[model samples]
Target: MKRSFSILSLLTQGTGLLALALALGGNPPARADENLFGFVRGAETLPKGHYDVYQTVTLRTGKDVGVYRGWDSDTEVEYGFTDKLQGSLSLVNRYIYNRGVEELDDTNHLTFGGFEGTTKYRILSPFKDPFGLAVRLETGWLLHDEVAGLLEHEIYVAPEIIVQKNFLDDTLITELNFGGEWAWGKDPAEQYYKEFSLQGGVGVTYRIAPKWFVGLEGHARGEWPLFNFNLFEHSVVYAGPAIHYATERWWVTLSYNYQIYGHGIDELPRTQTFAEETRHEIRFKVGFNF
Candidate 1:
Protein backbone atom coordinates (compact mmCIF):
# COMPACT_ATOMS: atom_id res chain seq x y z
CA MET A 1 0.00 0.00 0.00
CA LYS A 2 2.85 2.37 0.74
CA ARG A 3 4.44 1.59 -2.67
CA SER A 4 1.16 2.29 -4.43
CA PHE A 5 0.87 5.69 -2.73
CA SER A 6 4.49 6.56 -3.64
CA ILE A 7 3.93 5.71 -7.33
CA LEU A 8 0.83 7.91 -7.49
CA SER A 9 2.71 10.88 -5.97
CA LEU A 10 5.57 10.51 -8.48
CA LEU A 11 3.17 10.44 -11.45
CA THR A 12 1.44 13.63 -10.23
CA GLN A 13 4.79 15.38 -9.86
CA GLY A 14 5.85 14.36 -13.38
CA THR A 15 2.62 15.65 -14.91
CA GLY A 16 2.95 19.01 -13.16
CA LEU A 17 6.50 19.44 -14.45
CA LEU A 18 5.42 18.65 -18.00
CA ALA A 19 2.68 21.23 -17.89
CA LEU A 20 5.03 23.90 -16.60
CA ALA A 21 7.45 23.22 -19.41
CA LEU A 22 4.74 23.55 -22.03
CA ALA A 23 3.55 26.83 -20.60
CA LEU A 24 7.01 28.36 -20.49
CA GLY A 25 8.01 27.24 -23.98
CA GLY A 26 4.84 28.22 -25.80
CA ASN A 27 5.92 31.74 -26.76
CA PRO A 28 5.10 33.19 -30.21
CA PRO A 29 7.48 33.18 -33.13
CA ALA A 30 10.46 35.47 -32.69
CA ARG A 31 9.34 39.09 -32.74
CA ALA A 32 6.04 38.06 -34.25
CA ASP A 33 4.20 41.27 -33.47
CA GLU A 34 7.22 43.57 -33.45
CA ASN A 35 6.41 46.17 -36.07
CA LEU A 36 4.45 44.07 -38.50
CA PHE A 37 2.56 47.25 -39.32
CA GLY A 38 3.86 50.70 -40.05
CA PHE A 39 1.85 52.77 -37.58
CA VAL A 40 -0.15 50.47 -35.38
CA ARG A 41 2.23 48.59 -33.10
CA GLY A 42 2.08 45.18 -31.53
CA ALA A 43 2.70 44.08 -27.93
CA GLU A 44 5.96 42.17 -28.24
CA THR A 45 9.18 43.47 -26.79
CA LEU A 46 12.65 42.21 -27.46
CA PRO A 47 14.15 39.64 -25.18
CA LYS A 48 16.60 40.75 -22.53
CA GLY A 49 19.89 42.15 -23.87
CA HIS A 50 18.61 42.36 -27.43
CA TYR A 51 18.78 45.58 -29.44
CA ASP A 52 17.56 47.04 -32.73
CA VAL A 53 18.15 50.10 -34.87
CA TYR A 54 15.44 51.69 -36.96
CA GLN A 55 15.22 54.42 -39.59
CA THR A 56 11.98 55.96 -40.84
CA VAL A 57 11.02 58.59 -43.37
CA THR A 58 7.64 60.26 -43.87
CA LEU A 59 6.44 62.64 -46.55
CA ARG A 60 3.38 64.87 -46.42
CA THR A 61 2.06 66.60 -49.51
CA GLY A 62 -0.86 68.40 -51.12
CA LYS A 63 -2.32 71.05 -48.79
CA ASP A 64 -5.31 71.61 -51.12
CA VAL A 65 -4.33 74.78 -53.01
CA GLY A 66 -0.62 75.53 -53.14
CA VAL A 67 2.54 73.56 -53.43
CA TYR A 68 3.46 72.16 -50.02
CA ARG A 69 5.89 69.38 -49.30
CA GLY A 70 7.26 68.20 -45.99
CA TRP A 71 9.72 65.45 -45.24
CA ASP A 72 10.34 63.98 -41.81
CA SER A 73 13.16 61.63 -40.94
CA ASP A 74 13.79 59.75 -37.72
CA THR A 75 16.51 57.46 -36.47
CA GLU A 76 15.96 55.31 -33.42
CA VAL A 77 17.87 52.81 -31.32
CA GLU A 78 15.88 50.45 -29.13
CA TYR A 79 17.03 48.22 -26.33
CA GLY A 80 15.28 45.72 -24.19
CA PHE A 81 15.84 46.17 -20.48
CA THR A 82 13.87 43.02 -19.78
CA ASP A 83 11.46 40.76 -21.59
CA LYS A 84 8.51 42.94 -20.66
CA LEU A 85 9.99 46.42 -21.07
CA GLN A 86 11.84 48.23 -23.85
CA GLY A 87 13.02 51.77 -24.45
CA SER A 88 14.10 53.90 -27.40
CA LEU A 89 15.38 57.35 -28.29
CA SER A 90 14.91 59.07 -31.64
CA LEU A 91 16.45 62.01 -33.43
CA VAL A 92 14.17 63.80 -35.86
CA ASN A 93 14.70 66.14 -38.81
CA ARG A 94 12.36 67.85 -41.21
CA TYR A 95 12.44 69.67 -44.52
CA ILE A 96 9.65 71.80 -45.87
CA TYR A 97 8.98 73.51 -49.19
CA ASN A 98 6.04 75.87 -49.30
CA ARG A 99 4.88 78.22 -52.01
CA GLY A 100 1.52 80.00 -52.09
CA VAL A 101 -0.08 78.39 -49.06
CA GLU A 102 -2.11 81.10 -47.41
CA GLU A 103 -1.53 79.94 -43.88
CA LEU A 104 2.21 79.27 -44.21
CA ASP A 105 4.92 81.69 -45.19
CA ASP A 106 7.13 80.78 -48.13
CA THR A 107 10.01 78.60 -46.95
CA ASN A 108 12.32 75.94 -48.35
CA HIS A 109 14.84 74.52 -45.93
CA LEU A 110 15.77 71.56 -43.80
CA THR A 111 15.67 72.01 -40.03
CA PHE A 112 15.98 69.96 -36.94
CA GLY A 113 12.63 68.45 -36.05
CA GLY A 114 13.01 67.21 -32.45
CA PHE A 115 14.36 64.63 -30.07
CA GLU A 116 12.11 62.12 -28.40
CA GLY A 117 12.15 59.16 -26.06
CA THR A 118 9.71 56.30 -25.81
CA THR A 119 9.04 53.44 -23.44
CA LYS A 120 6.88 50.37 -23.92
CA TYR A 121 5.86 47.60 -21.56
CA ARG A 122 4.15 44.42 -22.59
CA ILE A 123 1.55 42.90 -20.31
CA LEU A 124 0.68 39.81 -22.29
CA SER A 125 1.72 37.76 -25.34
CA PRO A 126 -0.94 36.83 -27.87
CA PHE A 127 0.68 33.49 -28.51
CA LYS A 128 0.60 32.56 -24.88
CA ASP A 129 -2.44 34.40 -23.64
CA PRO A 130 -5.81 35.28 -25.08
CA PHE A 131 -4.45 38.47 -26.59
CA GLY A 132 -1.45 40.78 -26.48
CA LEU A 133 -1.47 44.06 -24.58
CA ALA A 134 1.03 46.85 -24.02
CA VAL A 135 1.34 50.41 -22.81
CA ARG A 136 3.55 53.11 -24.30
CA LEU A 137 4.64 56.64 -23.45
CA GLU A 138 6.46 59.18 -25.58
CA THR A 139 7.90 62.57 -24.74
CA GLY A 140 9.48 65.04 -27.10
CA TRP A 141 10.76 68.55 -27.56
CA LEU A 142 10.16 70.19 -30.92
CA LEU A 143 12.27 72.55 -32.99
CA HIS A 144 10.04 72.26 -36.05
CA ASP A 145 6.30 71.78 -35.91
CA GLU A 146 5.28 68.47 -37.44
CA VAL A 147 2.11 69.54 -39.18
CA ALA A 148 2.53 73.26 -39.85
CA GLY A 149 6.09 72.99 -41.23
CA LEU A 150 7.17 75.99 -39.22
CA LEU A 151 9.81 76.75 -36.64
CA GLU A 152 8.52 76.54 -33.10
CA HIS A 153 9.46 75.60 -29.57
CA GLU A 154 7.24 72.96 -28.09
CA ILE A 155 7.14 70.14 -25.57
CA TYR A 156 4.72 67.26 -25.83
CA VAL A 157 3.73 64.13 -23.96
CA ALA A 158 1.87 61.21 -25.51
CA PRO A 159 0.51 58.03 -24.00
CA GLU A 160 -0.85 55.03 -25.86
CA ILE A 161 -2.36 51.60 -25.32
CA ILE A 162 -1.89 48.79 -27.85
CA VAL A 163 -3.73 45.54 -28.31
CA GLN A 164 -3.02 42.66 -30.69
CA LYS A 165 -4.56 39.36 -31.64
CA ASN A 166 -3.57 36.51 -33.91
CA PHE A 167 -5.57 34.02 -35.97
CA LEU A 168 -4.97 30.97 -38.18
CA ASP A 169 -1.75 29.87 -36.57
CA ASP A 170 -0.30 33.38 -36.73
CA THR A 171 -0.98 33.72 -40.44
CA LEU A 172 -3.15 36.72 -39.73
CA ILE A 173 -2.65 39.46 -37.13
CA THR A 174 -4.70 42.46 -36.02
CA GLU A 175 -3.75 45.42 -33.91
CA LEU A 176 -5.51 48.45 -32.44
CA ASN A 177 -3.92 51.53 -30.96
CA PHE A 178 -5.33 54.49 -29.04
CA GLY A 179 -3.34 57.49 -27.96
CA GLY A 180 -3.55 61.16 -26.98
CA GLU A 181 -1.06 63.98 -26.95
CA TRP A 182 -0.81 67.25 -25.00
CA ALA A 183 1.49 69.93 -26.28
CA TRP A 184 2.62 73.37 -25.10
CA GLY A 185 4.45 75.58 -27.48
CA LYS A 186 5.55 79.08 -28.43
CA ASP A 187 4.74 80.30 -31.90
CA PRO A 188 7.01 82.49 -34.04
CA ALA A 189 5.24 85.50 -32.56
CA GLU A 190 6.46 84.41 -29.10
CA GLN A 191 2.91 83.69 -28.00
CA TYR A 192 2.22 80.56 -26.01
CA TYR A 193 -0.24 77.96 -27.23
CA LYS A 194 -1.67 74.76 -25.80
CA GLU A 195 -2.83 71.95 -28.03
CA PHE A 196 -4.30 68.50 -27.61
CA SER A 197 -5.04 65.68 -30.03
CA LEU A 198 -6.75 62.32 -29.91
CA GLN A 199 -5.64 59.53 -32.24
CA GLY A 200 -6.65 55.97 -33.03
CA GLY A 201 -5.55 53.38 -35.61
CA VAL A 202 -6.28 49.83 -36.62
CA GLY A 203 -4.20 47.48 -38.77
CA VAL A 204 -4.71 44.05 -40.22
CA THR A 205 -2.00 41.91 -41.81
CA TYR A 206 -1.90 38.56 -43.55
CA ARG A 207 1.18 36.49 -44.09
CA ILE A 208 1.25 35.49 -47.74
CA ALA A 209 4.77 34.10 -47.64
CA PRO A 210 7.56 33.47 -45.22
CA LYS A 211 8.74 36.79 -43.75
CA TRP A 212 6.35 38.80 -45.93
CA PHE A 213 3.09 40.42 -44.97
CA VAL A 214 0.58 42.70 -46.65
CA GLY A 215 -1.78 44.80 -44.63
CA LEU A 216 -4.16 47.72 -44.49
CA GLU A 217 -4.42 50.42 -41.85
CA GLY A 218 -6.81 53.19 -40.95
CA HIS A 219 -6.25 56.20 -38.72
CA ALA A 220 -8.34 59.03 -37.32
CA ARG A 221 -7.38 62.16 -35.47
CA GLY A 222 -9.11 65.16 -33.93
CA GLU A 223 -7.51 68.18 -32.37
CA TRP A 224 -8.38 70.99 -29.98
CA PRO A 225 -6.26 74.09 -30.42
CA LEU A 226 -6.61 75.25 -26.83
CA PHE A 227 -7.47 73.70 -23.49
CA ASN A 228 -11.17 74.31 -24.08
CA PHE A 229 -13.15 71.42 -25.54
CA ASN A 230 -15.43 73.74 -27.48
CA LEU A 231 -12.57 74.88 -29.70
CA PHE A 232 -12.51 71.78 -31.87
CA GLU A 233 -10.23 72.58 -34.73
CA HIS A 234 -10.29 69.75 -37.22
CA SER A 235 -10.72 66.05 -37.80
CA VAL A 236 -9.24 63.86 -40.52
CA VAL A 237 -9.29 60.19 -41.48
CA TYR A 238 -6.68 58.14 -43.35
CA ALA A 239 -6.67 54.66 -44.80
CA GLY A 240 -4.12 52.83 -46.91
CA PRO A 241 -2.21 49.68 -47.59
CA ALA A 242 1.21 48.57 -46.32
CA ILE A 243 3.72 45.95 -47.33
CA HIS A 244 6.51 44.53 -45.22
CA TYR A 245 9.40 42.16 -45.74
CA ALA A 246 11.56 40.75 -43.00
CA THR A 247 14.60 38.61 -42.63
CA GLU A 248 16.12 37.32 -39.42
CA ARG A 249 18.29 40.37 -39.02
CA TRP A 250 16.55 43.10 -41.01
CA TRP A 251 13.12 44.35 -42.11
CA VAL A 252 11.61 47.03 -44.32
CA THR A 253 8.09 48.36 -44.63
CA LEU A 254 6.29 50.97 -46.71
CA SER A 255 2.86 52.50 -46.40
CA TYR A 256 0.75 55.22 -47.98
CA ASN A 257 -2.09 56.91 -46.14
CA TYR A 258 -4.47 59.30 -47.87
CA GLN A 259 -6.96 61.59 -46.26
CA ILE A 260 -10.41 60.39 -47.21
CA TYR A 261 -12.50 62.65 -45.00
CA GLY A 262 -11.84 66.02 -43.43
CA HIS A 263 -13.79 68.74 -41.66
CA GLY A 264 -12.81 71.91 -39.83
CA ILE A 265 -14.05 75.39 -39.15
CA ASP A 266 -11.14 76.93 -41.05
CA GLU A 267 -10.85 74.50 -43.94
CA LEU A 268 -11.18 74.97 -47.68
CA PRO A 269 -14.54 75.14 -49.42
CA ARG A 270 -15.85 71.63 -50.26
CA THR A 271 -12.53 70.02 -49.24
CA GLN A 272 -12.22 70.54 -45.49
CA THR A 273 -8.62 69.64 -44.67
CA PHE A 274 -6.81 71.84 -42.20
CA ALA A 275 -3.94 74.03 -43.27
CA GLU A 276 -1.63 72.25 -40.91
CA GLU A 277 -2.20 68.79 -42.40
CA THR A 278 -2.12 67.39 -45.92
CA ARG A 279 -4.08 65.08 -48.17
CA HIS A 280 -1.44 62.39 -48.58
CA GLU A 281 1.29 60.79 -46.51
CA ILE A 282 3.89 58.16 -47.36
CA ARG A 283 6.17 56.40 -44.93
CA PHE A 284 9.11 54.07 -45.28
CA LYS A 285 10.78 52.21 -42.46
CA VAL A 286 13.76 49.93 -42.06
CA GLY A 287 15.12 48.13 -39.05
CA PHE A 288 18.10 45.98 -38.15
CA ASN A 289 18.31 43.70 -35.16
CA PHE A 290 21.43 42.80 -33.30
Candidate 2:
Protein backbone atom coordinates (compact mmCIF):
# COMPACT_ATOMS: atom_id res chain seq x y z
CA MET A 1 0.00 0.00 0.00
CA LYS A 2 2.81 2.40 0.80
CA ARG A 3 4.47 1.64 -2.51
CA SER A 4 1.25 2.28 -4.37
CA PHE A 5 0.80 5.61 -2.63
CA SER A 6 4.36 6.57 -3.49
CA ILE A 7 3.84 5.73 -7.13
CA LEU A 8 0.70 7.82 -7.29
CA SER A 9 2.39 10.75 -5.59
CA LEU A 10 5.33 10.57 -7.98
CA LEU A 11 3.04 10.45 -10.99
CA THR A 12 1.15 13.55 -9.83
CA GLN A 13 4.34 15.47 -9.10
CA GLY A 14 5.87 14.48 -12.42
CA THR A 15 2.81 15.59 -14.30
CA GLY A 16 2.76 18.93 -12.50
CA LEU A 17 6.40 19.51 -13.32
CA LEU A 18 5.87 18.62 -16.95
CA ALA A 19 2.97 21.03 -17.19
CA LEU A 20 4.98 23.81 -15.63
CA ALA A 21 7.85 23.17 -18.01
CA LEU A 22 5.57 23.33 -21.00
CA ALA A 23 4.00 26.53 -19.76
CA LEU A 24 7.40 28.18 -19.43
CA GLY A 25 9.17 26.72 -22.42
CA GLY A 26 7.69 28.60 -25.33
CA ASN A 27 5.59 31.51 -26.51
CA PRO A 28 2.11 30.04 -26.54
CA PRO A 29 -1.12 31.68 -27.48
CA ALA A 30 -2.72 34.06 -25.02
CA ARG A 31 -4.82 32.28 -22.41
CA ALA A 32 -8.56 32.67 -22.38
CA ASP A 33 -10.96 32.37 -19.44
CA GLU A 34 -10.48 28.85 -18.14
CA ASN A 35 -13.21 26.32 -17.51
CA LEU A 36 -12.58 26.60 -13.80
CA PHE A 37 -15.02 24.30 -12.04
CA GLY A 38 -13.47 20.91 -11.48
CA PHE A 39 -16.52 18.90 -10.51
CA VAL A 40 -19.19 20.57 -12.63
CA ARG A 41 -18.16 21.24 -16.18
CA GLY A 42 -19.13 24.55 -17.77
CA ALA A 43 -20.69 25.27 -21.15
CA GLU A 44 -17.61 26.99 -22.54
CA THR A 45 -15.21 25.43 -25.03
CA LEU A 46 -11.60 26.26 -25.63
CA PRO A 47 -10.62 28.80 -28.23
CA LYS A 48 -10.05 27.51 -31.72
CA GLY A 49 -6.58 26.03 -32.28
CA HIS A 50 -5.84 25.95 -28.55
CA TYR A 51 -5.10 23.03 -26.25
CA ASP A 52 -5.34 22.27 -22.55
CA VAL A 53 -3.82 19.49 -20.46
CA TYR A 54 -5.02 18.73 -16.95
CA GLN A 55 -4.47 16.35 -14.04
CA THR A 56 -7.13 15.74 -11.42
CA VAL A 57 -7.05 13.73 -8.19
CA THR A 58 -10.15 12.75 -6.26
CA LEU A 59 -10.66 11.17 -2.84
CA ARG A 60 -13.84 9.65 -1.46
CA THR A 61 -14.49 8.04 1.91
CA GLY A 62 -17.43 6.48 3.70
CA LYS A 63 -18.38 4.72 6.89
CA ASP A 64 -20.40 1.63 6.18
CA VAL A 65 -19.49 -1.57 8.05
CA GLY A 66 -16.20 0.19 8.68
CA VAL A 67 -14.25 2.74 6.76
CA TYR A 68 -13.97 2.71 2.97
CA ARG A 69 -11.68 4.98 1.03
CA GLY A 70 -11.22 5.47 -2.72
CA TRP A 71 -8.76 7.49 -4.74
CA ASP A 72 -8.73 8.34 -8.42
CA SER A 73 -6.24 10.13 -10.64
CA ASP A 74 -7.19 11.30 -14.09
CA THR A 75 -4.91 12.83 -16.71
CA GLU A 76 -6.49 14.50 -19.68
CA VAL A 77 -5.52 16.20 -22.91
CA GLU A 78 -8.13 18.41 -24.55
CA TYR A 79 -8.02 20.21 -27.84
CA GLY A 80 -10.24 22.63 -29.67
CA PHE A 81 -11.00 21.26 -33.13
CA THR A 82 -12.99 24.37 -34.02
CA ASP A 83 -14.56 27.42 -32.47
CA LYS A 84 -17.62 25.40 -31.55
CA LEU A 85 -16.19 21.95 -30.97
CA GLN A 86 -13.67 20.32 -28.62
CA GLY A 87 -12.43 16.83 -27.82
CA SER A 88 -10.60 15.20 -24.93
CA LEU A 89 -8.89 11.93 -24.02
CA SER A 90 -8.09 10.78 -20.53
CA LEU A 91 -6.36 8.00 -18.58
CA VAL A 92 -7.68 7.01 -15.18
CA ASN A 93 -6.15 5.18 -12.22
CA ARG A 94 -7.99 4.16 -9.08
CA TYR A 95 -7.24 2.73 -5.65
CA ILE A 96 -9.41 1.50 -2.80
CA TYR A 97 -8.65 0.70 0.83
CA ASN A 98 -10.91 -0.70 3.50
CA ARG A 99 -10.31 -1.22 7.20
CA GLY A 100 -11.95 -2.01 10.56
CA VAL A 101 -14.46 -4.56 9.29
CA GLU A 102 -13.25 -8.00 10.20
CA GLU A 103 -14.23 -9.56 6.92
CA LEU A 104 -12.72 -6.75 4.89
CA ASP A 105 -9.83 -5.45 6.95
CA ASP A 106 -6.48 -4.79 5.32
CA THR A 107 -7.97 -5.17 1.86
CA ASN A 108 -6.30 -2.57 -0.33
CA HIS A 109 -6.00 -2.59 -4.09
CA LEU A 110 -4.82 -0.30 -6.90
CA THR A 111 -5.58 -0.63 -10.59
CA PHE A 112 -6.20 1.18 -13.84
CA GLY A 113 -9.76 2.48 -13.94
CA GLY A 114 -10.20 3.03 -17.66
CA PHE A 115 -9.71 5.18 -20.72
CA GLU A 116 -12.28 7.89 -21.49
CA GLY A 117 -12.98 10.10 -24.46
CA THR A 118 -15.26 13.10 -24.73
CA THR A 119 -16.58 15.55 -27.29
CA LYS A 120 -18.36 18.82 -26.65
CA TYR A 121 -20.13 21.11 -29.09
CA ARG A 122 -21.25 24.62 -28.38
CA ILE A 123 -24.61 25.48 -29.93
CA LEU A 124 -24.88 29.01 -28.59
CA SER A 125 -22.38 31.40 -27.07
CA PRO A 126 -23.32 33.63 -24.15
CA PHE A 127 -21.16 36.36 -25.62
CA LYS A 128 -23.33 36.48 -28.67
CA ASP A 129 -26.59 34.98 -27.44
CA PRO A 130 -28.75 35.38 -24.33
CA PHE A 131 -27.39 32.19 -22.79
CA GLY A 132 -24.68 29.69 -23.56
CA LEU A 133 -25.79 26.29 -24.77
CA ALA A 134 -23.72 23.13 -25.36
CA VAL A 135 -23.82 19.39 -25.38
CA ARG A 136 -21.25 16.75 -24.43
CA LEU A 137 -20.83 13.02 -24.97
CA GLU A 138 -18.45 10.79 -23.08
CA THR A 139 -17.57 7.12 -23.28
CA GLY A 140 -15.25 4.85 -21.36
CA TRP A 141 -14.05 1.24 -21.36
CA LEU A 142 -12.78 -0.42 -18.23
CA LEU A 143 -9.33 -1.93 -18.72
CA HIS A 144 -8.14 -3.39 -15.42
CA ASP A 145 -9.07 -5.99 -12.85
CA GLU A 146 -11.85 -5.18 -10.40
CA VAL A 147 -10.73 -3.19 -7.39
CA ALA A 148 -11.58 -4.49 -3.93
CA GLY A 149 -14.00 -6.99 -5.47
CA LEU A 150 -16.01 -4.42 -7.37
CA LEU A 151 -16.55 -5.19 -11.03
CA GLU A 152 -14.60 -3.04 -13.51
CA HIS A 153 -15.23 -4.69 -16.85
CA GLU A 154 -17.85 -2.52 -18.42
CA ILE A 155 -18.52 0.01 -21.16
CA TYR A 156 -20.39 3.20 -20.34
CA VAL A 157 -21.90 6.09 -22.21
CA ALA A 158 -22.83 9.50 -20.81
CA PRO A 159 -24.53 12.40 -22.48
CA GLU A 160 -25.20 15.86 -21.07
CA ILE A 161 -26.52 19.27 -22.01
CA ILE A 162 -24.98 22.44 -20.58
CA VAL A 163 -26.53 25.86 -20.06
CA GLN A 164 -24.85 28.99 -18.81
CA LYS A 165 -25.77 32.56 -17.92
CA ASN A 166 -23.46 35.34 -16.93
CA PHE A 167 -24.26 38.36 -14.79
CA LEU A 168 -22.55 41.38 -13.18
CA ASP A 169 -20.42 42.24 -16.21
CA ASP A 170 -19.32 38.63 -16.66
CA THR A 171 -17.91 38.43 -13.15
CA LEU A 172 -20.70 36.24 -11.85
CA ILE A 173 -21.62 33.08 -13.75
CA THR A 174 -24.16 30.33 -13.32
CA GLU A 175 -24.43 27.00 -15.11
CA LEU A 176 -26.83 24.08 -15.23
CA ASN A 177 -26.25 20.57 -16.48
CA PHE A 178 -28.49 17.55 -17.10
CA GLY A 179 -27.13 14.15 -17.97
CA GLY A 180 -27.61 10.41 -17.92
CA GLU A 181 -25.28 7.44 -18.05
CA TRP A 182 -25.66 3.78 -18.97
CA ALA A 183 -23.29 0.93 -18.24
CA TRP A 184 -23.48 -2.69 -19.37
CA GLY A 185 -21.42 -5.56 -18.01
CA LYS A 186 -21.50 -9.06 -16.62
CA ASP A 187 -20.75 -9.82 -13.00
CA PRO A 188 -18.35 -12.47 -11.75
CA ALA A 189 -21.31 -14.86 -11.56
CA GLU A 190 -21.91 -14.14 -15.25
CA GLN A 191 -25.12 -12.34 -14.42
CA TYR A 192 -25.63 -9.56 -16.89
CA TYR A 193 -26.97 -6.26 -15.60
CA LYS A 194 -27.26 -2.78 -16.97
CA GLU A 195 -26.90 0.24 -14.70
CA PHE A 196 -28.71 3.42 -15.59
CA SER A 197 -28.18 6.70 -13.81
CA LEU A 198 -29.53 10.24 -14.10
CA GLN A 199 -27.57 13.25 -12.93
CA GLY A 200 -28.04 16.99 -12.76
CA GLY A 201 -26.31 19.96 -11.19
CA VAL A 202 -26.15 23.73 -10.87
CA GLY A 203 -23.14 25.91 -10.15
CA VAL A 204 -22.69 29.58 -9.38
CA THR A 205 -19.36 31.37 -9.35
CA TYR A 206 -18.14 34.91 -8.87
CA ARG A 207 -14.79 36.29 -9.89
CA ILE A 208 -13.08 37.70 -6.82
CA ALA A 209 -9.93 38.85 -8.51
CA PRO A 210 -8.36 39.10 -11.89
CA LYS A 211 -7.24 35.48 -11.64
CA TRP A 212 -9.27 34.06 -8.80
CA PHE A 213 -12.85 32.86 -8.42
CA VAL A 214 -15.06 31.30 -5.76
CA GLY A 215 -18.17 29.21 -6.23
CA LEU A 216 -20.68 26.70 -4.94
CA GLU A 217 -22.39 23.80 -6.64
CA GLY A 218 -25.13 21.29 -5.94
CA HIS A 219 -25.58 17.90 -7.58
CA ALA A 220 -28.14 15.10 -7.53
CA ARG A 221 -27.89 11.58 -8.88
CA GLY A 222 -30.11 8.53 -9.00
CA GLU A 223 -29.51 4.96 -10.16
CA TRP A 224 -31.91 2.34 -11.50
CA PRO A 225 -31.92 -1.35 -12.43
CA LEU A 226 -32.40 -1.59 -16.17
CA PHE A 227 -34.01 -5.02 -16.51
CA ASN A 228 -37.02 -3.99 -14.51
CA PHE A 229 -36.85 -0.55 -16.14
CA ASN A 230 -38.64 1.13 -13.24
CA LEU A 231 -36.84 -0.17 -10.16
CA PHE A 232 -34.88 2.50 -8.34
CA GLU A 233 -31.71 1.23 -6.81
CA HIS A 234 -30.17 4.27 -5.16
CA SER A 235 -29.99 8.04 -5.01
CA VAL A 236 -27.48 10.57 -3.63
CA VAL A 237 -27.17 14.32 -3.39
CA TYR A 238 -24.06 16.46 -2.86
CA ALA A 239 -23.22 20.10 -2.32
CA GLY A 240 -19.88 21.88 -2.07
CA PRO A 241 -17.76 24.93 -2.46
CA ALA A 242 -15.09 25.38 -5.14
CA ILE A 243 -12.20 27.73 -5.78
CA HIS A 244 -10.16 28.43 -8.87
CA TYR A 245 -6.96 30.29 -9.76
CA ALA A 246 -5.61 30.89 -13.22
CA THR A 247 -2.89 32.66 -15.14
CA GLU A 248 -2.08 33.17 -18.79
CA ARG A 249 -0.61 29.69 -19.04
CA TRP A 250 -1.71 27.63 -16.05
CA TRP A 251 -4.77 27.10 -13.85
CA VAL A 252 -5.89 25.11 -10.81
CA THR A 253 -9.13 24.25 -9.00
CA LEU A 254 -10.08 22.63 -5.71
CA SER A 255 -13.44 21.49 -4.41
CA TYR A 256 -15.06 19.44 -1.65
CA ASN A 257 -18.45 17.76 -1.89
CA TYR A 258 -20.29 16.03 0.93
CA GLN A 259 -23.13 13.63 0.36
CA ILE A 260 -26.04 15.23 2.13
CA TYR A 261 -28.41 12.37 1.53
CA GLY A 262 -28.43 8.82 0.22
CA HIS A 263 -30.93 6.01 0.05
CA GLY A 264 -31.20 2.38 -1.06
CA ILE A 265 -28.61 -0.20 -2.18
CA ASP A 266 -25.73 1.41 -0.28
CA GLU A 267 -24.58 -1.81 1.32
CA LEU A 268 -23.56 -5.19 0.00
CA PRO A 269 -22.02 -8.50 1.03
CA ARG A 270 -18.45 -8.51 2.27
CA THR A 271 -17.23 -9.62 -1.14
CA GLN A 272 -18.84 -6.65 -2.87
CA THR A 273 -18.43 -4.09 -0.12
CA PHE A 274 -16.18 -1.92 -2.23
CA ALA A 275 -19.14 -0.88 -4.32
CA GLU A 276 -20.67 0.92 -1.39
CA GLU A 277 -21.37 4.62 -1.64
CA THR A 278 -19.22 7.27 -0.02
CA ARG A 279 -20.06 10.10 2.34
CA HIS A 280 -17.91 12.79 0.85
CA GLU A 281 -15.58 13.55 -2.05
CA ILE A 282 -12.67 15.93 -2.64
CA ARG A 283 -11.15 16.95 -5.94
CA PHE A 284 -8.10 18.92 -7.08
CA LYS A 285 -7.25 19.77 -10.65
CA VAL A 286 -4.37 21.53 -12.39
CA GLY A 287 -4.06 22.43 -16.04
CA PHE A 288 -1.75 24.00 -18.56
CA ASN A 289 -3.13 25.82 -21.55
CA PHE A 290 -1.45 26.48 -24.88
Q: List per-prediction Cα lDDT, in the order shown.
A: 0.85, 0.79
lDDT of 1 at 133: 95
Candidate 2 local distance difference test against the native: 0.79
- Residue 282's lDDT in candidate 2: 89
* lDDT assessment of candidate 1: 0.85
User: Which window of ten consecutive residues has the lowest lDDT sum in model 2?
Assistant: 267-276
On a 0 to 100 scale, what is the lDDT of residue 283 in model 2?
Answer: 88
- Give the per-residue lDDT of model 1 (tens digit) for 1-290: 99999999999999999889879995444552257766778888887788889999999898877898899999999998998999999999998888888767788888889899999999998778899999999999988787555678888899999899999998999999999999888476223488889998999999999989999998889988775678888788888999999987789999999898888765556654856678898999999887
How many clashes show up in model 2? 0
- Estimate, for each residue in 1-290, the C-alpha lDDT of model 2 and write its tens digit: 99999999999999998898888975566564476576787788888899999999988876655777779889999999888899999998888787874344466888778889999999998667889999999999875433354554778899999999988888898989999998777354123467788999888999999989999987888877664556767677888999999888899999888887777554543322224456778889999988
Instruction: Provide the lowest-lDDT 10-residue window in model 1.
Output: 26-35
Off by over 4 Å in 1: 1-33, 189-192, 269-271
Taking all chains together, each candidate's TM-score versus the true structure is: 0.86, 0.81
